[model samples]
Target chain A: MNSAHSDIDRVPMQLVQGCLVASVQVELSPEVLHVFQQDLLEAVRRTRARATVLDLSGVSILDSRDFRSIERTLEMASLLGAQPLLVGIRPGIAASLSELGAQCAGFAAFSTLERALEHLDSAG
Target chain B: MIELGTMQIRDEEAPVQIRVKVLGLLVSLGADEVLATRVATAASELSHRYQLLGAESRCRCVLHNEYSSLLVEFRFTSAHPHPETTDLEGIAGVMRMGRNGTGTDELVVQIKLPMPRDGLSKRAIARGRERILQRSRRELMDELRAKNAELEAYNETLEETVAERTRELTHANEQMARDLSAGSEYVQGLIPDPIEEPVRVDWRYIPSSSLGGDTIGYHWIDDDHLALYLIDVTGHGLDSALLAVTVMNVLRAGSLAGVDMVDPDRVLFALNNSFQAHHHGMKFFTIWYGVYQPSTRELVWSGGGHHPSILISPGTEAPAMLEATGPLIGAVEDMDFPAERCTVAPGSRMAIFSDGVFEIIRDNDLVWTWEGLVEFVDTLRGAKVPLADALLQEAERIKGDASFDDDVSIIEAVFP
Candidate 1:
């Protein structure tokens, strides 16, 4: 689904088992990221998912602003009664995130979708 | 003998008519071409100014033979008298202020020329008089032709000089470009080869067209401690690259006297003290320095206004970003870089890169953010592609046909 701005497409949000999985594949502008955050939180509330896995394997680069947005999204997801897990950070992206000082210390992280699912499953 | 001519100034054409009458009288008096033109121009200016007073103005010219001198006098009268004759300072040969018999304010400007000598015989005098009248017309035509030739020569010289200066400038610019290209090559050669050891180090470096300031290197401080760093100077070009190379050399040699190379904080502190921003043409740099001890699987790191190193452990989904612990190097005096430690598991990967690695503009004019880089790298997790190749390919894909705006440098170390 398209957001209010026709230029930005919606992030794919799926209800997998008891978790909400949002695969963010496209390059996110600040405006698009804002829309995605709101949509993800709304989806979590509607599905009543206990956990959410944010797949960032498609994101190859991030700036400081985008990093801050992801941090806020994680915080908001937790506030909405869902444990947010960031998964599949590529090596280059991981290096860049560290370089930008986006420690992402507020949420849990998994290297792969399977690992993230297993961790969430065990925790649940 | 005296010849008198009078002209009334009623309109703008009055000055032109007065100049023609004065020039004819001067030429008849056998005056030189230069002197005749000067007197004609001065008479024209005076008549024009006198007409501006808006009164009945009349110009009277009298050519008379006075002893051995031929005197030409131009007298102008205006009903509205203006005694301000200072405007005639550099114009007329002599300006006599007097009143006519009717008591009108009159200005008389006289131009005197030397007459033919009295020693000349009657026959020579007659011939001289005839020659003066005949050659005067031809002389005026010759003077006009000479002036036009002078102007044409001056224009040609000006064009030639402009062309010569343009050629010199083009040559200088081309030489400078060649020197810069050679200098950039030398700087690229300064980067050390990759290390294939307990910690396999692989790096990718692409200098921007303007030669940006990015230098990365890793060296073994001892059998146990391995020091790795990435330094980004404030700008591009020779100066920034030179500063980067200087910092790299010092790091490579572990040459900071009395500072422990294994300690990231101490090393950065010494570097800050050594390369003060004020001393280096006000240039400053950001640096990420880390000392890894394979024995303990621990990395002690510190940064000066630099992005943190990403530590991706084995079996971990999210990589940890190690951020800067201090301000930029050479920017401030007495700055401290506190060291932080993180455990690096076997089969884990750590990447230290400059901001240029991810600060790319996409074809759509949007920046390829760090999030995009992360997602792209995640897809290569199990793939056999090297980290540097993967990053370069992804960057190219994101950038499309556009070249990088800054130098991109990356150092990826895999612990087997």
Candidate 2:
């Protein structure tokens, strides 16, 4: 029998200067996305991270369902008292999302990781 | 206990007398108002039909209270023997037709009424039965008149509600049409006029909806280079059109700080950095940007998630499709778009278009592919018909319709 935990690809996250920096490098299936949300929220609780930055530079295709997941993640972070920021969205992905009326309402978006970090640092 | 009553119908007034007796029995049985009215109505109809046969008609009604239920059985007989049971409308009871043992035809109707939850005393039942029997015909007629007025008022209210909802829906539809028309006009105004310079340029645009997202424009960056671009934003309608117009305005203004407008790769890179998908309502677009150097007769181009521009040079039998240099723009960060160079000789022509031009459904229910577009263009290479008009005609022929499912935009540049 295959083990229940055989193929779980956890999203890579790090703690930097009292903040949680989670980088999503792989295409997130629905199941994996749900697991990621649970794990990220648990990590935030454990580290008591002051801020959260989701680096989505690698995501090329984003549909309405994916945007909904991202919205839920941002909402979760805010509920946990962590300021969430998004960085590194490609132009083509932006066009597709904008066409669907997906607005970055709760989170701030930056073109580069460095810029996003700089903004977070200065704001803090 | 069971009680039986018999009536012989000899004239028109006999049916009414029987109907009053049925109502009295129902009230004594403690049946609800609606059930009592329905049972009485059924009894009247059966007796009336028997009287119309013009024969000796007799109706036998038996009322019994058993196992907390009121059971009323109506047995109707006529001398004609062929008693038609046609007046059973709106009766919520069981009925049976059978011949009696006395060589006579009979129609039997059985109505069962469950005892009310609040059981009535024997005295109350007797009093109710007495009250119904005491009411005159005038009072009964007045009660029927009141019920008709109530039903008419209810029907009027229902009709008025339907009319108000239809008016609201029509108004909303008209408002939407006006908004769409205004949006289409604004998008049309954003398209640049044809430029007659070292390079001749003309284009065509058609939106499946009132607003389109396909935008094409070309302008001279300097004396050395002419910058040309075609962009197709995802989806259609007002949001897509607005994003396409925003990108066009930025490119026209040359407002990206420290970016070289004449360089194809730099232009795409700057656009990607500015319109990151997450920042601009999570929207992304495909762009093909190229710069033509008249001095060198070289066309240097770069594309981000966009189909390559088609180049047709002198003495070449087929058009060359310049492949994409990098990934689609606005999705990833710090992406590099490499430029590809091709020299254009005199009398050569080049075309840049959105994917909608080739991905159309033809009359045969097949998609018009890039190869099909190339073959169509080949036929109109040297013809007197303009390139934009020729492509539009081909699209119409393939679609067999005037409208498309997506926004179609095509730009044609002819080198003199």
Instruction: Flag regions of model 1 displaced more than 4 Å.
Output: A1-124, B3-155, B361-366
CA lDDT of each prediction against the hidden true structure: 0.77, 0.75
Interface RMSD, one decimal, each candidate: 37.2, 33.4
**Against the true chain A, what TM-score does chain A of candidate 1 give?**
0.93
Model 2 chain B lowest lDDT segment of ten: B129-138
lDDT of 2 at B278: 89
Worst 10 residues of 1 chain B by lDDT: B129-138
Per-residue lDDT of candidate 2, residues B105-207 (tens digit) = 6788788877665654566556544543444343466688799889899989989999999999999878877886787777767777887768899888887
Tell me how far the alpha carbon of residue B357 in candidate 2 is from the true structure, in angstroms, after superposition: 1.8
Per-residue CA lDDT of model 2 for A1-124, tens digit only, reads 1255345556889998877988888655455577778878988998998888888887644444567887898789879988888888766456545544677889899987788788978996
Each prediction's DockQ against the real complex: 0.00, 0.00
True contacts kept of each: 0.00, 0.00
Best by TM-score: 2
